[model samples]
Structure formats: structure tokens, C-alpha cells
Target: MLRLIIKKEIQSALRDTRIQFAGTFLILLMLVSVLVGRQGQKQIQKERAEAQATMYDKWVNQGAKHPHSAAHYGQFAFKPKPVLSFLDLGLDNYTGVSVFLEAHKQNEVLYSAAQEGNGMTRFGELTAALVLQVLLPLLIIFLTFNIFSREREEGTLKLIHGQGISMRKLLMGKVWGTYALVLLIFIPVICLAYFLLDQASAGFDPHVGVKFMGLLASYSLYLLIFVLLSVIISAFSKSSSFSLLSLLGLWIAACIILPKATTNLADKVYPTPSQYEFRKTIAEKVENGIDGHNPSDARLADLKKQVLDEYNVSKTEDLPVNWRGIAMQAGEEYTDQVYDHEFSKVENIFKKQNRVSEWAGFINPYLAIRNLSMAFSGTDFHHHVAFVKAAENYRRAFVKKMNKDMEVNDKPGTEDYRVDKEMWESIESFSYEAPDIGKIISVQWRSVTALVFWLVALFTLASIYAPKISRL
Candidate 1:
């Protein structure tokens, strides 16, 4: 009986010209987004990879120079593109792609894609994730908003009941049929997405397959919420037009208004310090005591005394190994401590800011899916922070190596000291591996919980409304 009802609804929907046109247009739009995203991803990957290789070459071949001078010459740390980036782009456009690593100061990632683009680019970059998250819900609303109300308006609701078909079964069948329409439209896009991803590189990441499947599952739940909500609203409405209007309003609230408002509220609640103040705070804490090599620092005088005592030397020119390098390394270590504290405070503020919307995921499946989608794609805040920290660690290690080389190879009190290009080998080739799926799930646990909450809530609503279909 359920099969018969589903077949009838499917046949009826197939006969509706509106479904055909809407489905076609949505598919075309998604395909276009995928095409544009693919080109952008390929181009971005090629450019960053080439730039990194060139930068490394320059670093190794840079003529023999004083260790400090070579440290100042610096290397660029270019972040590699994630394999799933084509699907979501996410914060990649907003976050910087490269960072400059030098001696005295740590650098923020620089040269974000948004910085290079025009003002209009801030509107949002087009990607398959945007198509599925925002626009696809619009299509689902168009398809399912009137599924029950139109039957009632046409007086077929009672007539179908008159045939002894329970309203609950009928509603379930309609829900399945409407959802099938979405699958029909989305399946081709899914297949095409897989093909494009498979063909994009010579080697495949196993994790990409896992991440892609998770993307499908998350988006399916998101679409299901829209389907169930639309049908529920239709069941409660007197007219199909009213149902459509009501669903549209709900869509705008969940998808548009709430997201923007949450961000604003989060900012107001947890304000971050200004850049100058942040830097000033770090300098105040670490400047005087850390750098024992600085001649004027009375704070370093004690450290200098201890070092000379440990080296068993009474005068400046007597101790073996460059005590200056030892002092510099100690200063670098202290500077790292100061920066780490300051950076955590800043990062915590950012966490609080995003937490506001993450909680709103319970009210808006759109937010839940947005977070999960970016997490899986490795373009979320969590992923960006991981990359940033990894780059910083590499920079610190490279600086320490240079300092040690200075201490061991160069004589004390010699301004003419220099190192061969071979010293560049102390720094390893930089590579980044994104956090695994397990780590991503931990970071986005709230979003995952919200998605699960919607599944239970929407399903419960669907069951409750299924039995109440007679009221319409």
C-alpha cells in the first residue's frame, strides 16, 4: 500500500511541469558552480606549489652571509590546498595563503585571496557547497512546501481518505516522493563531483573519499530537514500559497538572518584587542629580560653573569662557543613564550565569536551543515588554525637551527663571521598534512550534535504532523 502511494505521488509529481523546470535550472546552476570551483582550485594549487618551490630554491642558493643576515632573508611558508577545497572554498578565500618567517617577529598569514580581489569578491565565492547549502534548499521549498496543502485545496485529500488510505501513510508517501525528486536532481551532481575529484590529481588522498562521503551524509540530513519542515508547514496551512510563503519566511530566517546576527552578537560579547595593543602587551612582558645578547639590557646582565659563571670564564673573549648565540636562543625561547600567550588570547576571542553561531546550529541546520562542510573540507577555522600553528612551529625550528649554527661555527667577537650555503640544509622541506577526520569531528562536535538534534527533532515533527494531516 505504501509503495502504491509513493508511485502515485511520483507519477503525479513527474506530470508537474514546475518540478521539471526547477530541477533543471538547479542542476545547471550547480554544474556551473562546480566548473568554476574546479578551475579556481587547480589554478590556486599550481600557483602556490610553484611559489613555494621557488622560495626554497632562493633560500638554499642565497650567497654565504652572516647567520643573522641569512635569518632576516627569511622564507615564505605557503599553505597547501586541501583536496576537498573545490567543494567548499570555505574560509580559504578569507584566510591568508602565505606567511613570512623571519628572525625577530612572528608573522600572520599574509596575502589572502580576498585581498587580491575587488570589493565585490567579499560578497562570497561561488562553490558547490554554496549551491547545495543555500540554493538547493530554495528548490526543496518550491517542491515540498505545498505537497499536502495543494491536495487539500484540490479536494483530493478527503477523496483519497475516502478510499480507505490512511492520511499518515499518504503523507509519508508524499514526503518520500518529494525527497526522491531532490535525489534525482542531486545524484548526477554527486557523480560528476566524484569524477572531477578523481581526475584532478595523479595521486588520490584516501581521506578525501572519507570526507566526501561524510559531506554527502551531512548534506542529506540538511536537505531532509528542509523536506520535513516544508511538509509540516504545508500540513498546517489552509492554502498552498500560504504554505509556500510561510516556508519562504522560515528559510530566510534560518539561512540568512540568523547567521549574520549570531556573528554580530558574538563580536559584541567577546571583543578582541587591537593589533598595536596586542603587540605592545607582548613587548612589555618579554623585551627587557629575554635578550641577554643586547648590551644595554640590565635585565640581561644577570643572565650574562650566570652564563659567564657556567662557562668558567671571567672575561668576554675567553669562553668557547658563541655565548652570543646561546643568549639569542634563550631570548628566542622567551619571545616564543610571550607570543604564545598573546596569540592564545586572540585565538580564544575568535573561538568565542564562532561559538555563538555554533550554538545557533540547533536552531538552524544551515549553520550546522556550514560548519561541518567546512570542517570536512579542511577550510574551517579549526583547520586554518592548525595550519597556522604548524607554519609557526617550522619557523621557530628554522630560527633555532640558524642560531645554533651561529653559536658553533663562528668565533666570538668576530663581525666577519659567515656560514656556507650548506647550512640551509638544517631546515627541512616544509609540508602540511591536514588534521584527520577524527580530529575534525572533535573540533566540530557542537555542529555534529546540532545536526543530530535536527534529525531527531524533524523526524519527531514529521511523525506528529503525519497523523494530524486530517486537520488540513
Candidate 2:
């Protein structure tokens, strides 16, 4: 009987003009979004690669110059584009994609896509993930919101009741049948996009397949929760109009209103410092702590005395190594400490801001899936932070190499200590590999738990109430 009901539901839905139109529009929207996203991804990848190569060439080919000067003439570190980012852009647009690595300064990532765009960009670009996360649920609501309520309104519930079919069985059939219809509409478009993507790629990435599967699984559960909620609402609704309005209200709250509201609340709770203030704070700390460039500074004088005593020499000029290089390196280390401390406070504030939304996933599955999607796509804050850390580490090594060269080879009294391209070439280029999927999932346990809880709670609600819903 359940099977028959499911079959009837599918057959009837298939004949509906509204379902046909919505499905077609969704398919078209996804097709365009995928193609556009792929093109944009390719363009960004190419641009980053060319820019990085140019920066590398300039650094390596820079002729003989002062070692400290060379340290100041730093390189740019471009963040590698993740393969799945084309499918789900996440924070990649807002977060800058490259960082300038130089001496005594930790630069923020530069050249964000959002920075280049106009006001309309704030609304967000249409990506396949957006369609799935926002629009597809709407279609599900449209399909399932009036299921049981319409049956009651048209007096078909009396027929089903007269046939002695339990409301639980009928509800189950509608849920499964609607889910099957969704798959029918959704699968072909996704498969077509995947096929195009595989053909478009220059090389194979094994992780892409695995990550894609993870996306599929996550979206599957997410969509199921919506379908279940829609059917359960329909089953209890007094009329078709009430069912439609209720589901629309729920959709708007989950998909639109709550996301914005939660973000605003988080911002109010944990305010982040402005960029100028953050930089100003770091500069003040470094200035007060040590002046590596100024040998006349009191701290540098102390450092010089301490270094001379450690070497058992009365004067810096009498010492074997260059005092200037030692002072410069000491300043670099002091500045690094200041940057790290301030950056840590900023990072903590971001984490706390993110936490509010992550926990809000329990109330809105949209937030849960949004965070999870960003993680899997490697566009989340954690991934961006990892890239920045890698760049900073490279920058530190780079400055150290220059300082060590001057200390070892230059005369202590030399005014212009120079090193050639040979010394510059000694420092390694920056490289970053995104954290593995397992690590990403570990950081997203809150969202994962929320999704699981939503699934269980929806099923529990259906089980308890479906049997008790009035037939007429």
C-alpha cells in the first residue's frame, strides 16, 4: 500500500505544470552557474599562477645589493585554488588570495574578488552551492507543502481514511515520493555539470572525487530534512493556504532572516578591531619594544652590550661577526612577537564570531550546510589562516637567511654589506598544501552534530505526530 501511494504521488507530481516549470528553471540556473563558476575559477587560477611566477622571477633575478635591502625587497605568496572551490566559492571572494612577504612586517592577504566588485556583489554570485542550499529547498517546499492539506481540502483524505490507510504510512509515502522527484530533477543537472568539469580539467585530482562525494552526501541529508519537515507540516496543516504560508515562513527564517540576524548578533558580541587599529597597535608595541634599524636606541644598546659580553669582547667592532646584522635580526624577532600576539587576539575573536553561527546551526540547517560546504571546498577561515601562516613562516626564514649571510660574511665596520643573486636564491619559494579533509571535518564537528541532531529531531517529530494528524 505504501509503495502504491508513493507511485501515485510520483505519477501525479510528474504531471503537474508548476513542478515541471520549477524543475526546468532550476536545471537551467544550475547549468549557467556551473559554467560561469568554472570560467571564473580558471581565470583566478591562471592569474595567481602568472603573478606568483612573475614575483619569483623578479626576486631571483635581482642583482647584487645589500643583504638587508634584499630582505626588504620581498616576494608575494599566492594561495592555491582548491579544486572544489569552483563548485562552492564560500569565503574565497571576501578573503584575499595572496600575501606580500617582506622583512619586519606581516602583510594581510591582498586582492580579494570582493574588493574589485561593485555594490551588487554584496548580494553574492550565483553558484551551484547557493542554488542547492537556498533555492532547492524552496522547490521542495512548493512540492510538499500542500500534500496532505490539499488531500483533506479536496475530500480525498476521507477516501484514504475509508480505505483504512494510516496517516503515518501516507506521510512516509509522500516524503519518499517527493524526495524521489527531487532526485529526478537534481541528479541529471549535477551529473551533466560533473561530466563537463571532468572534461574541462587539465589534470586528474583523486581528492576531487572524494570531496564531491562528501558534498553529495551532506546535501542529501540536508535536503531530506527539508522534505521531512515539509511533509510533516502539510500533514498537520488545517488548509493548503496555511501549509504553504507556514512552510514559506519557515524557509524565509531559516534561509534568509536568521542567518543575517545571527551574524549581526555575533558581531555585536565579539567586535573585531579595524585594520588601521590592528596595525597601529602592532606598530606601537614593536616601536616601544626595540628598534632594530636604530643602533642608538637604548634597547639596542643593551642588546649590543649583552652580545659583546656573551662573546667576551669589549666592543662590537672588535667582535668576529657584524653587530648591524645582529641588531637587525633581533629587531625582526621582536616585531614578529608583537605581530603574533596581536594576530592571535584577532584570530580568537574570529573564532568566537564563527562559534555563534556554528551553534546556531541547530536552529538553521542552512548555516550548518554553509559552514560544512566552505570547509570541504577549502574556502573557510581555517584554510585561509593556514595559508597565511605558511607565508609568514617562509617570510621569517627568508629574512633570517639574509641576516645570517650578512653576519657571517660582512666585516663588522662595513657600511654597505651586499649579497648577490646567489644569496637570494638560497631562500625557498613559498608553497602551501591545504589541510586534508579529515582535518577540516574535525574543525566542523559543531556543524556536523547540528545536522545530525536536525535529522533525528525531524524524524522523531514525524513519527510522533503523523499517526495523530486528522484525516479530514
Candidate 3:
């Protein structure tokens, strides 16, 4: 009987010209978005690779001075685009891809794609995730809003109910039919994306594969919730139009308005200090105490004296190491400590701000799904933070290595000491490996749980109340 009902619903849906048009339009949009996103990803990858190559060629081929001087010259860290980023675009379009590493200062990643144009981007970009999250739900609502009410309005519901059919079976059949329609519209695009990515890149990693599948599964569950919720609204409402308007309002609240408003509210509530203020405060603290940027700081004078005494040298110049290099390295280490302290403070503030949005998953499934999707795609705040942390780690290692080399090779004084450019070439450049998707999923476990709860809640509601349609 359920199979018969599903077949009836599918045939009825296909026979409707409006439904066919919507399905066609959505499929076409998905295809176009996939193509555009892949092309954009390729272009970005090429540009970043070229930029990193240029930096390396300039640093290695050109003659450099001392190892410490070379540290001051620094290098760039270019974030590579994840293979499946094309499917979601997630935070990629919002976050910066490149960070400049140099001596004694930490630079913020620059060049956000969001800041490139006028305020037009506030409407959001066209991507597979956007379509699946926002538009596809609306399409599902359109198809399911009248599932029971329209039959009642036509007096067919009474006839069917009188025939002794169960309302649960009827509603389940309807939901399944609508879900199939959505899959038909979405699956082709997903398959095509996989094929294109595999052909373009070496091959998709298993981790990426898991993330992609998780994305698809979460999105489908999200769509099911919308279908069931819409059906419930239709079952309870007196008319089709009212059900639609209610569902539309719910959609706007969930997908469009709430996420942005919550993020802004989180920012206001947390009130993180500006970057300038943060840096200034750290710098002032350092100056008043250790003066981490200056090796000859008064606070460090005792330490320097102890070192001199231990070496049995009357002057820093009389020691085995170059005093200037030793002082510069000491200064750098102190400043690094200060920066790390400040960086942690800033990170804590941002995490507090994001926590508000994270908790908003209960109010809005779109928020939950968006967070999960971006997390899996390696384009969330966590992923961005990982890259910054990796860069800092690389900076500290590079600086320490240079300081160790200076201690071993430097002549004490006379400003006559220098390392060959060959030594600089021998030092390894900074490289970043993106974290596995499993790690990302683990970090975003709360959002995943929220999505699952949403699905279970809706399914439970549908199962319980759907039979009440006959009462209506």
C-alpha cells in the first residue's frame, strides 16, 4: 500500500509542469555552480602555487647574508584549497589564503574574497551547499505543503481515509516521494563533482571522501526534516497557502536571518579587542618588563651577566658566540613568548564569540549544517586557526634554528661574521599539511549531534502526529 502511494505521489509530482520546471531549474543551477566553483578553485590553486614558487626562487637563488638576517627576510605560507571546497566554498570565500611570516611580528592573513567587492556579497555566493541548504528546502516545502491539505480540500482525503488506509503510511509515502525528487535533482550534481575532482586532481583522498559523504548525508537528512515539518504544518493548517507562508517564514528564520544576526550579537556580547589594541597592549607590557624585542633590556641584564660569568668572559665580545646574534636571538625568543600569550588571548575571545553561534544550532538547523559542512570541508574557524597555529610553529622553529646556527658559527665581534647563502638554501621552507577530515568531524561533534537531534525530533513528530491527519 505504501509503495502504491509512493508511486502515485511520484507520478502526480512528475505530471505537474510547475514541479518539472523547478526540478529542471535546480538541476541546471547545480551543474553551473559545480563548473564555476571548480574553475575558480583551479585558478586560485594556480595563483597561490605561482606566488609560493616566486617567493622560494627569490629567497634561494638570491644571495643572502647571515642566518638571522635571512630570518628577518622571512617567507609566505599559502593555504592550499581543499579538493571538495568547490562543492561548498564554505568559508573559503570569506577567509584569507595567505599569511606573511617575518621577524618579531605576526601578520594576519590578508586578502579575503569577501572584501573584494561592494556589499553585494551579503546576499551570499552561488554554491552547491547554498542551493542544497536554502533553495532545495523551499522546493521540498512547495512539493509537500499540500500533501494532505490539498487532498482534504478536494474531499479525496475523506474518501481515502474511509477506505481504511493508515495516515502514517500515507505521510511516510509522501515524504519518501518528495525526498526522492530532491535526490534526483541533487545526486547528478554530486556525482559530476566527484568525477570532475578526481579527473582534475590526482584522486580524492579517503578522508575527503568521508567528508563529502558526510556532507551529502547531513544535507539529505536536513531536507527530510523540512519535508516532514512542512507536512506537519500542512496537516495542521486549514489551507495550502497558509502552510507555505508558515514554512517560508521558518525557512527565512532558519537559513537567512538568524545565523548572521547571531554572529553579530556574539561579537557584540564578547567584545573582543581590536587587533591594534591587542598588539599595543602586548608591546607595552613587554617594554615595561622584559622588552622582548631588545636583547639589552634592563630586566635581561642580570641574565646576560650570568651568561658572561659562566663563560668566564669579561665582555660579550670575548665569548665564543657573536654577541649581536646572541642578543638578537634572545630578543626574538622573548618577543615570541609575548606574541604567543597575546595570540592565545585573541583566540579565546574569538572562541567565545563563536560559541554563541554554535549553540544557535538548536534554533536553526541550517546553522548546524553550515558549521558541520564547513568543518568537514576544512574551511571553518577551527581549520583557519589550525593554519595560523602551524605558521607560528614554523616561525618559532625557523628562528630557533637560526639562533642555534649563529651560536655555533658566529665570530664574537668586529661585525665581520656572516654565513654563506648556501646555508640559507639548506634550511627547509615552511610547509603546511591540512588536518584530516576525521579530525575536523571530531572537533565539530556538537554540531553533528545537533543535526542528528533535529532529524530524530522531526521524524518522531511525523510518526506521532501524522496519524492525526485523519482527525483533521
Q: Write the per-residue lDDT of candidate 1 for residues 1-472, one digit (tens) a residue.
A: 8888778767877788987888888888888878778778888888988998999989988988888788889998899887788889899988989999988788878888799889877988778888899988898888777778878888888788889887677777777777787788788888888898878762434577778888888888888777777877888788888998999999899888988888888889998899889888778778653233333366467778887898889965787778778778877887898799889989999988888778889988899999999988879998899988998898898888889888887767677998867888667767777788888787788988998898888777777667666643
**What is the TM-score of each predicted model, taking all chains together?**
0.95, 0.94, 0.94
Give the range of the ten consecutive residues with the poorest summed lDDT in model 3: 288-297
For model 1, the superposed segments whose C-alpha errors exceed 4 Å read 202-206, 288-299, 413-415
What does candidate 3's lDDT look like per residue over 214-290, in tens digits? Answer: 87777877777777777778787888888888888988888879987998899889888987898787777667643
TM-score of 3: 0.94
How many steric clashes does model 1 contain? 0
Ranking by TM-score: 1, 2, 3
The better-scoring model by lDDT among 2 and 3 is 2
Query: Among these predicted structures, which one has the highest lDDT?
Result: 2
Count of clashing pairs, candidate 3: 0
The clash numbers for all candidates, in the given order, read 0, 0, 0
lDDT over C-alpha atoms for residue 163 of model 1:
91
lDDT of each: 0.82, 0.85, 0.79
